[model samples]
Target: MFKILDKQELAESIIEYTIEARDIARHHHAGQFCIIRVHSHCERIPLSIAETNSQAGTITLVVQIAGHSTQELAQLEAGDSILDVVGPLGQPTKIGSPRRGIFVGGGVGVPAGSSMVRQMKQAGAQVLAIIGFRSKDLIIYEEKMRAVADELVVTTDDGSYGYHGLVTEPLQERLAAGEKYDVVITVGPVVMMRAVAEVTRPYGTHTIASLNPIMVDGTGMCGACRVTVGGETKFACVDGPEFDAHQVDFAELAQRLEIYRDEELRAHEAGPHECRLEQALKELG
Candidate 1:
């Protein structure tokens, strides 16, 4: 069992968890993720490694409560133990020492992208970060991203904070102004990632996108997280959670993600399986 060292709510239904996993924390690199199981019976879920503290033997995971399993995870507090926490999984991003790089993120993706931002800066790259949220209340990891990026641009769709526009707006503006980046990396919803790819396409910028697919196992054996890039197949679990944005078949990827929608909705509606009746019976006993 891995203990929950700390837990803080970053936003509504969004949590930042610091868990005790020494080896994983020590070896995890930028752009890698972990698969966690709240209990032995719960389904496993993948989450990006937001930060790590090797000395403390902890790894930080930012989790958004989306369905049953995550809702169960949220119920646990500091000192609670998790049944399984496996990883440092997937490929660590290849930073290549680009002279100038742009990192874009949307919603919860902001924290995920922050990992790469720090690495790019350490690689001696001038990093520009553009992060967006639906509103001010949804913004997270702003200070963290800002500290690593040479410049940071925050956007909101509702004009509630920062720039009153989509994240792609500032990116488009920058490219239109003749700004060139050695590479552009975006992590967000499929639609948002696709938009970033399109915005950079005209400028011929080399762009990378971190993908979120339906993953059963964190290993390649499951074959559940396969995606098409450059008209070929690759698994998100083992091959990547990141790929060339321009080469990805976004439509197919988006369609594949929705395959479990009904089941997911049912799980959410069913709520956490604490079995109140059984609990009451045990109390009587």
Candidate 2:
């Protein structure tokens, strides 16, 4: 059991947990993720490693309470133990001395991009970050991203803060203004990453995307996280959670993610049984 050393609410329905996993924390690099099981009966879920401290023997995971498993995980507090925490899985991002690089993130993807930006800066690259959210209340990791990036642009769809537009807007404008980038990295919803790829493709910029598909086992045995890249089959679990943006078949991946929608809805509707049943029994009494 891995103990929850710390927990912080980053935003509404979004929380960050620091877990005691010394071995994984010590070896994890940027762009790798961990598979966690809230309990023995719960399905395993994959989450990006937001930050790590080897000395502290902890790794930070930022989670959005999207479905049943994540909502249950969020209920855990400091000192609570997680049943299974398997990790340092998938290929780490390849950091090199690119002259200039752009990192783009949306919603919860911001935390996933944070460590990557730091690694890029450490490798002597001029990193620029563009992050998007629905509104000000949904934004997270702004200061963290700003600290590592040479330049940071925050955008909101509702005009609540920073620039009032999608993250792709500034990126498109920058490329239109003749700004050059050696590489572009993005992490977000499938549609958002697709948009980023479209924007960067014409400029001949190399783009990398961190994909979050429906994954069962963190290892390659399950075949649940299979995706098509360059017209070939690849498993996101072992081969990558990261891939070339140009080669990913986004439409197929998007469809596959919805395969469990009905089951997910049923789980959410059921909610936490103990709380639900206890409240109902009290009201009846």
TM-score of each: 0.94, 0.94
Where is the poorest 10-residue window by lDDT in model 2? 273-282
Badly placed stretches (over 4 Å) of model 2 are 270-285
Candidate 1: residue pairs that collide: none
Candidate 1 least-lDDT 10 residues: 275-284
- lDDT by candidate, in order shown: 0.89, 0.90
| Model 2: per-residue Cα lDDT at residue 19 | 96
- Against the true structure, candidate 2 reaches a TM-score of 0.94
lDDT of 1 by residue, 1-285 (tens): 999999999999999999999999999999999999898667788999999999999999999988777888999999999999999999999869899999999988888888799889888999999999999998899999988899999999999999999999999999999998999999988999999999999999999999998777678986678899999999999999999999999999988677565566766666666433223223434
* Candidate 1 structure lDDT: 0.89
Report the Cα RMSD per candidate: 6.0, 6.1
Superposed model 1: Cα runs more than 4 Å off: 270-285
Model 1, total clashes: 0
